[model samples]
Target chain A: MNKNINHLVNETLDSFAHLQKVAAPDGLNERILQRMNQPKGSKEVYLFRNAQWLIAALVIGIVCNVYLAISYNNKGESNGTETSTISSFESHFRLETTTNLYE
Target chain B: MSELQLIAELKDGNQQAFIKLIDLYKHLVFNTVLNMVQQFEEAEDLTQEVFIQVFQSIQHFRGDSKLSTWLYRIAITKCLDWQRKNNAKKRMNSMKSIFGLDGHQDIIPDFVHPGIQLANKEKATMLFKALKQLPENQRIAFTLIKADGLSYEEVSEIMQTSIKSLEGLMHRAKENLRKSLEQFYKS
Candidate 1:
C-alpha cells in the first residue's frame, strides 16, 4: 500500500512536469505570420527578378569579347595579304628592269 | 484553425494559419523537444523549427495519418537531427561534468525544500532530468503517450511502427523510468 501511494505521488509529479508552463516568446507569432504574408520566391522570380542582371551582364561581356577577337583576327589576315601583294609587285618591277638592261 | 485548415493555409504560405497551428500544438512539440533536448530555451527553438518544417512540408502530409501524429513524427525527427548536428558531444561532455560519469542517473535534492515555492514546477524540473536519462526511443514513446495523451494507435502511426511494437516500447519505457526513479530516490 505504501509503495502504491509513493508511485502515485511520483506519477503525479511526472505528469505535472509535462504540463506546459513556458509561453512562446512574444512577437514570434507575428514574425512568422509576416514571413508567410510575403510572397515566396518563385522560379520565375529567381530567373528574371533575382539573377537576370548578372546573367545579362555576362552574356553581353562574352559577345563583346567574341566580336573583338573575330575582328582582330580578320584585320591581321588582311594586313598579311596586303604585305604579300606589295612584295610581289616590287619583285615584278625589279625583274622587268633587269630584263630591259640585259637586252 | 483546424489541423486540416492549418495544413491548407500552411501550404499556401498563410502565416497566421501557422501561428494558430503553433498556438494549438506548441505544447505538444515543446514537451517532446524538452524531453529530447532538456535545455528549456533550446527546446523552445526546436519546437519553432518543428513548426517551420510542418509549414514547409505541409503539402506532403497526404492526410493518410492524423495531423497530430504526423507532427509528432516530424518533431521527434527534428529533435534527433538537431541533437546529432549541433551538440551530441557537447551534451555528453556536459553530462559527464554534472554526473561525474557518462550516463549516470541525476540526483536532484530530495529534501523537497519543505514545500518549495512553486513545488510543482520544481518537481517538473526533476522530471525533465529523469526524462533525459531514458533511452532514446523509450523517451519518445513515453513522452508521446504520457505527455501528449496520444492513443497507442496514434503513437504507433507517429512512430511508424506496429501496435505491438509500440506496446513493447511503452513497457520498456515504464520499466526504464521505474529503474531510474529507484536510483534517483535512493540518492
Candidate 2:
C-alpha cells in the first residue's frame, strides 16, 4: 500500500515533465483584432459615463427652478399688497371727486 | 524591433505594433490561460480578452515590469475572474437543485492538456483535478512554475512575492496534491 501510494504521488508530481507548449488556435489573432477594432465603449459604459452629467444637470435645474419660484412668489405677494392699497386710494379719490361734482 | 521600441509603438497605437504584439505573445498567453482554465474555448476567449485589455491599457504600462510579466498578470487575473464566476454559477445551480428548480448541473469532464505526452495523460488529468482543489495562490504558483514553464524568479516577479514565499506555497501545493492523489488512488 505504501509503495503504491508513493508511486502514485511521484507519477502525478512528474506528470508535467517534458510537456510541450501548445500553439494558439489558428486565426485567433484575427479574432482578437476584430474584437479590438469593434467600437470601444459599450452602451452600458456610454450610459454610465453620461449618467453623471445628467444627474448634475438635473440637480442644477431643480435648484434654479426652486430659487426662481421662491423669488417670484415673494414678488407676487408684495405686489398684491401694493395693488390693493392703490386701488383703495383710487376708489376714495373717485368718491370725493364725484361728491364735489354732484354739489 | 526592440522591446522598448515595441512598447513605445504600442503606446502610440501603431497598428503594425499591435499585430506584432499579438503574434509574439499570443501563444504564451494562450498556453498559460489554457493551463489555468483547462478548457480550450474558454481559454481562447479569455486569451483574447487579455490581449484586448492589454491593447486598451497599454498607455498605462509605465514599463515598470517586463511586458511579458504584465501580460501574465492580466491573463492570470482574467482566469481567476472566470474561475470565480464559474464557482458562483455552480453554487447557484446547486442551490436551485436543492429547491427543485430547473437547474442543470455542470459536469466537469476530464481535461487532458494538449501538450502532455500520451503516457502521462491519465496521471496529468488526475493531477489537474487535484490541482483544482488547491487554494488560489498555491494553484497559481504551481501552474506558473510547473505547467507554464516559468522560472521561479519570473513567477516570483509575476506573483509579486519573494522566492521564499513562493517556495512555501509550492511545497504546500505539492503536499496537498499528494494527499488528494492518494485519496483518488485509494478510491
Candidate 3:
C-alpha cells in the first residue's frame, strides 16, 4: 500500500515537473512600466476631491455668519423701535394726565 | 550591462534599464506567482506588482543574495499576501451570510494552470486542489521546488529557512498531498 502511494504521488508530481514556463500576457511589461511611471501619490486627486467639500464648508460657514449677523441686526432694530414706541406712548399719556389733572 | 550597473541605473531613475530588468525576469516571476496563486490573471497582476515594487525599492537592496533570490522572495510574499487577503474576504463573506446580512457564495477556485499538458490536466488539477489544502510554508516550499525548479539551497535562501527544515517541510508536504490524493481517488 505504501509503495503504491509513493508511486502514485511520484506519478502525479512528475506530470508537473517540467511545466513549460508560461509566457506572460501581452502588454504586461507595458502595464508595469505604465504603473511605475505613474505619479507616486494621489495627492492631486485627493486635493481635488476635498476641494469640493472645502468650498462647500466655507460657503456654509459664510452663509451662516451672514444670516446670524442680519438676524441680530434685525432684532436690535425691532427692540429699538419697540422701546421708542413705548417711551413715546408713555410721554403722551403723562402729558394727557397732567393736562387733565390741571384742568 | 552587468546587474550591478543595471541596479545603479534603476536607482538613478533610468527607465530603459528598468524595462531591461523586467524583460529579463518577467517569466520567472510570473511563473512563480502563477504556481502559487493558480490563477493566470491574478498571477499576471501580482507579477506586475512585484516588478513595480522592485522598481520602487531597488535602492534598499543591499545585495545580500542573488537578484533572482530577492525577486523570488518578493514574488512569494506578494502571493502569500494575496492569499491572505482572499481568505479574509471569504471569511468576511461567510460571516455576513451567517449573520443574515447578505447571502454570500463561496469562491470556487477554477484554476486551470496553462502549463499542464492536455493529457495530464485532470490529474494536475487534482494535485493542485490537494496542494491548496497544505499549510502555507509547505505549499510554498513544494511549489518552489516542484514547479519553479529551484534547488533546496536556493529555496532555503528564498524562504529564509535552513535546508534541514526545508527538507522536513517538503517531506510533510508530500505526505499531506499523498493523503489528500488518496482520499481524492477513493472518492
Candidate 4:
C-alpha cells in the first residue's frame, strides 16, 4: 500500500513536469520600463506636489500676523487718546470747581 | 551580449541593456513565481516587481552568484512576501466574518495552471491542493526541484542551504507530499 501510494504521488507530481511557462501579459515590459524611467522615491514628489498648499498656508499665516499687529496698534492708539481726553476733562472740571469755590 | 557585459551596462544605467536583460529572464522569473503563487495575474505582477527591483539594485549586486541565481532569489523572496501578506489578509477577513463585521465568503483555492495538459488537469489540480498545504520551505524545495527544473545544487544555492540539508529538505518534501496525497486520496 505504501509502495502504491508513493508511486501515485510520483506520478501525480511528474504529470506537472511539462508545465509550460506562462507568457507575461502584453505591454508588461513596457510598463516596467516606463515605471523605471519615471522618478523614484515618491516622498519628494508628494512634497513638491503640495508646495502650493504649503506656500498658501505660509502666506495666510503672515497675513494674519500683520492684520493682528495693525489692529492691536489701532486699539492701543484709541485707548491712549481716550485716556488723554479723560485727563484733560478732569483738569478742566477741577479748575471750574476751584473758581466756583473762590467765588 | 555576454552576461557580464550586460551586467556592466546595466550597472552603468544603460536602458537598452536593461531591456535586453528583461527580455532574457522574464520567462524564467514569471514561471517560477507562477508556480509558487498559483495566481496568473499576481505572478505576472510579481515578475514585474522582481525586475524593477533588479534594475534599481543592480548596482549593489556583488557578482557573488550568477545573475540568474540572484534573480531567482529575488523572485522567491517576492513570492514568499506576497504569500505572507495574502495569508494575513485572509486571516483578517476571516476574523472580520466571525465577528459579523463582514459577510462570510469562502476563499477559493486557485489551482489553474494554463500550462497543464488537459488529460493531467484533474490530477494536477489535486496535487496543487496538497502542495499548498505543505509548509513554506518544503513547498519551495519541492517546487524548485520538481516544477522549476532546478538542480539540487542550484536549489541549494538559491535557498542558501548546504547540499546535505537541501537533500534532506527535498526528501522530506517528497515524503510529506506523498502522505498528504495519500490522505487526500483515502478521503
Candidate 5:
C-alpha cells in the first residue's frame, strides 16, 4: 500500500511531463486585431459619454456653493445684529468699547 | 524581425507588426492562460485580452526584461484577476444560498488539460485539483515551472522573485501536492 501510494504521488507530480503546447483558438488574431482597432474612447470621451454624471456632479457642486454662500450671508447678518446689540448695551451702560483691563 | 524592432513597430501601432507579435507569442500566452484558467474558451478570451493590453501598453515597455518575460507577467496577472473574479462570484453565490435566494451554485467540473499525455490524464486531473488547493503563490510558481515549461530563472524574472525563493515555493508546493495526492489515492 505504501509503495503504491508513493507511485501514485510521483506519477501525479510528474503528470506534466511531455506536455504539448496547445494553440490559441482559430481566428483569435483577427478577433484581437478587430478589438484593437475598435476605437478606444479617450478619457475625455469617456467623461463626455457619462455627461449625465458630470452634469449631476456640477449641479451638486453649484447647489453646495449656493448653500454655503447663503449660510455665510445669514451668519454675517447675525454677526452685524450682535455687534449692534453689544454697542447698544455698551452705550446704555456708559462702557468704553476698548477698555484695557490689563493696563 | 528583431524583438526590439517588433516592439518599436508595435509601439508605433503598426498592424503588421502586431500580427507578427501575436503569431510569435500567442501559443505561449495561450498555454499559460489555459493551464491557469483550465477552460479553453475563457483562456482564449483572456489570451486576447493579454495581447490587446500588450498592444495598448507597448509604449511603456522599458525593455528591462525580455518581451516574453513581460508577456508572461501580463498573462499571469490577467489569469489571477480572472480567478479572483470567479472566486468572488462563488462567494456571492454561497451568500445567496445562505439567504435562501435562488443562487445557482457554480459546480466546477473536473478539468482535463488537453496538453497532458493520454496515459497521464487521470493522474493529471488529480494533480490539478491538488494544485488548486495550494496557496496562490505556490500554485503560480508551480504552474509556471511545470505546466508552462518555464525555467527557474525565467519564472523568477516573470514572478519578480529570487530563484532561491522560487525554489522554496516549488518545494512547498510539491510537498503539499504530494500529501494531497497521497490522501486522494489512499481514499
Candidate 6:
C-alpha cells in the first residue's frame, strides 16, 4: 500500500512537468529564416568542401580497407603456422566475445 | 490540397503551398522536435530545418511513409546531429579546461519543457528526463508510443523492428524510466 501510494505520488509529480508554450519572445522564426537564407558565400566553396570531405573519406576508407584486408590476410597466413592458430571453436565466438570484451 | 498537389505546386514555384505545408506541420514538427530537444527555440529551429530539408529532398519523398513520419525522421536526425556537435564541443572544451586553459563547459541549449504544465511537475520532468536518458532505440520507441501515441505495431513499422523487438525496446524503456523516477518519487 505504501509503495502504491509512493508510485502515485511520483506519477503525479512526473505529470506536472511543463505543459505549455510562451511564444519564443517573437521574431525568433524570422531570425531563423534570415540565418537560413544567408548566402553560403559561394557554391564553389561548398563544392570544394564536399570535394575535400570525399577525398578524405576515400583516402581513409582505402587505407582502412587495405589495412583490414592486409591484417586479415596476415591472420590467415599466420594461422597456416601451427603456433599462431587457436582452436576452431574460437572462430564462432569472435563476434560475441569481442562485444563482451568492450561492454 | 493533396500532398501530391503540394509537391507539384512547390516544384512549380508556388510559394503559398510551401508556406501552407510549413503552417500545417509547424506544430507537429515543433512538438516532435520538443520531445527530442527539450528547448522550445531549438525545437522551432529544428522544425524550420526539417521543412527546409523536406523542400530539398522533395524529390525523394517516395510516399512510402506518411509525410509526417518522414518529417519526424528528418527532424530527429537533425536534432541528433546537433546534439552530437554540441557534445563534441563540450568534450573539446573539457579537454582544454583540463589543460589549464579557460573555456566554457558547453551550454546545453535551454528550452521550456511542455510537460511542466501538468499538476505533477517534478514527476513529469523526471519521467521525461528519464525518457531522454534512454538508449537511442528505446528513446525513439518510447517517444513514438507515449508522445506520438502510436500503437506498438505502428512504432514497429516506423522503427523497422519486429513487433517483438519493439516490445523489448518498450519494456526496457519503461523499466529505465521507472528506475530513474523511483528515486525522484521516493524523495
User: Positional deviation of A8 in candidate 1, in angstroms?
Assistant: 9.0
Q: What is the TM-score of chain A in candidate 4?
A: 0.35
**Winning candidate number (lDDT):** 2
The alpha-carbon deviation from the true structure for residue A62 of candidate 5, after best TM-score superposition, in angstroms, is: 18
The docking category that best describes candidate 2 is medium
**Each prediction's DockQ against the real complex:** 0.07, 0.59, 0.41, 0.42, 0.62, 0.16
Q: lDDT tens string, model 2, A9-103?
A: 89889898878999999999899989987886888989989898999999999999777666655554665643343454565578789999999
Q: Give the lDDT of residue B57 in candidate 6.
A: 83
The estimated TM-scores of all candidates read 0.58, 0.79, 0.76, 0.75, 0.79, 0.69
Better of 3 and 4 by DockQ: 4
Predicted candidate 3 versus true structure: per-residue lDDT over A12-33, tens digit per residue: 8676875778888889889998
Candidate 4 per-residue C-alpha lDDT over B121-140 given as tens digits, one digit per residue, 9 for 90 to 100 = 87788878888888898899
Per-residue alpha-carbon lDDT of model 3 for B18-133, expressed as tens digits?
A: 89999999999999999999888889999999999998789999988988999999999999999999999888988889999985876667676788788877778878888899
- The Cα local distance difference test for each model comes to 0.69, 0.91, 0.86, 0.85, 0.88, 0.69
Estimate, for each residue in B1-187, the C-alpha lDDT of model 5 and write its tens digit. Answer: 8999998888888989989999999999999999988888899999999999998799999999999999999999999999999999999989999999987896779889887888999988888889889998999999999998889999999999999999999999999999888888888
Q: Per-residue CA lDDT of candidate 6, range B1-187, in tens?
A: 8877887787776667767777777766777677777776667777778877877788777778777777777877887887788779888989988998986684553333654454555555556666767888888887767765668876676677799999988788777777766665566
Q: Which stretches of candidate 1 lie over 4 Å from their true place?
A: A1-22, A33-103, B1-6, B91-123
What is the lDDT ranking, best to worst?
2, 5, 3, 4, 6, 1
- Tell me the TM-score of model 6: 0.69
Clashing pairs in 3: none
Better of 2 and 4 by DockQ: 2
